[model samples]
Target: MRLRLRQFRLRTGPHEHRVVQPGQPLRHTSLRAPEPIGTLLGDHDGLNRLAGLFSFAAYSRHTIVHVPLRDSVPPDEGVGELVDLVLAHHTLGLRPSRWPALRRNLVGGTPLTVRTDEARTDRDSTSWRERHERTDGRGDLRHATHARTFFLFGNRDVFASAAMSLALAAGWGPRQKGVVKGHSAFMTALPTLVQPPGGGHPLELLVCFKPYPPYAHFRRPGRRGERRSAPS
Candidate 1:
């Protein structure tokens, strides 16, 4: 069966930016500032609704690692604590140890760190792109050819247009397989066009619907619960 690979980017904020190459420096920074806490929470709620739709699908085994490319300042609780914050608030399911060496390598290094929450704020966007390329070559990321891989970026266009080009130019397509998923105000903002490497399959956009706040009104209360009197 032909695999239905999908790709896109996650837009954290108007100013949030990303680099596709993994080891290069971020050439530009997002003009938008970090999203407000309320907005983030709302987005998470939407994601949860979407997740419910795929609960029954037979998804392949996959691991999610949080790369601290940006927001590297160690919170009062440190990187591990920050990872937990992402989990509890966003339900992203990222583990703390997935990128254990992120702190020391955020700067002066390849710009890619598997560390927890070390603030990577200092480095510009190009760094993450360069680091992603390096990791794709030397790390478990190489498994993409055999297993489906997805690189979720802050902006799909930026990474796809920039990073994919670099990978192709460097002769890395045969080894890397999978797609990019872009996150925007809504998933619909992602582009419909995609030119796969070396005449590969075209990129596809997958839409997952998120439940809106009004859904709560449609839900019925449990039988065991005592009902309160309706207001006149």
Candidate 2:
């Protein structure tokens, strides 16, 4: 099989999330996750904007990817060149294991639906999660929404996550989570097995992400005015 590369861009900084610069996370009461403090992507126009960039949904419909889901690619090569560049040089302290991932079909951005009898017990519940899982629990709790999700990730983790997201997008389908949110540049790529014009099967690469001012800093609500971002 032969493989080619295609590219796309997902401008994520426009959404509520930003990169975690090298400093204390200026914790926000209204932010998504509370940890080293990561922001979560939510059901907003931002997600829709990001989703509009990819046509994996359309591409898959038009063409056939040569690689079989069972024949998983290696972590080093699974997501392809651009992500490999990210993991290899951009990501600090991360190893190949950090990039382990699976692929799925590219579905809608978020707010995907799932069915259940009762409700969602997960930290956060969303129709998308259920759809990704593609199942509803047999119990009473069903059709839960608003599951806590990582809409954006801390800078430390974003690089690694982006690779995983791409791998995931190729398989189960593309969704909002398939992006690595960053301050200056949000990164995402699509890994697909595509049909070349010659009629043989090959792998293809698609890349994209939101663009933002590199290191736009915001003041903490309180304290000595800690910052989630540092000037680049």
What TM-score does each of the candidates earn?
0.20, 0.19
Instruction: Please provide, for model 1 over 48-86, each residue's C-alpha lDDT reduced to its tens digit, 9 standing for 90 to 100.
Output: 222221110112112122222233222121111121111
* CA lDDT scores, all candidates in order: 0.23, 0.23
Weakest 10 consecutive residues, lDDT, candidate 2? Answer: 17-26
- After superposing candidate 1, which stretches have Cα over 4 Å from the reference? 1-149, 152-194, 198-201, 212-232
Give the per-residue lDDT digits (tens) of candidate 2, residues 111-204. Answer: 2221211122121123323343343312111110122211221121222223344333332221234222322122333222112246543322
> What C-alpha lDDT, on a 0 to 100 scale, does residue 38 get in candidate 1?
9
**TM-score leader:** 1
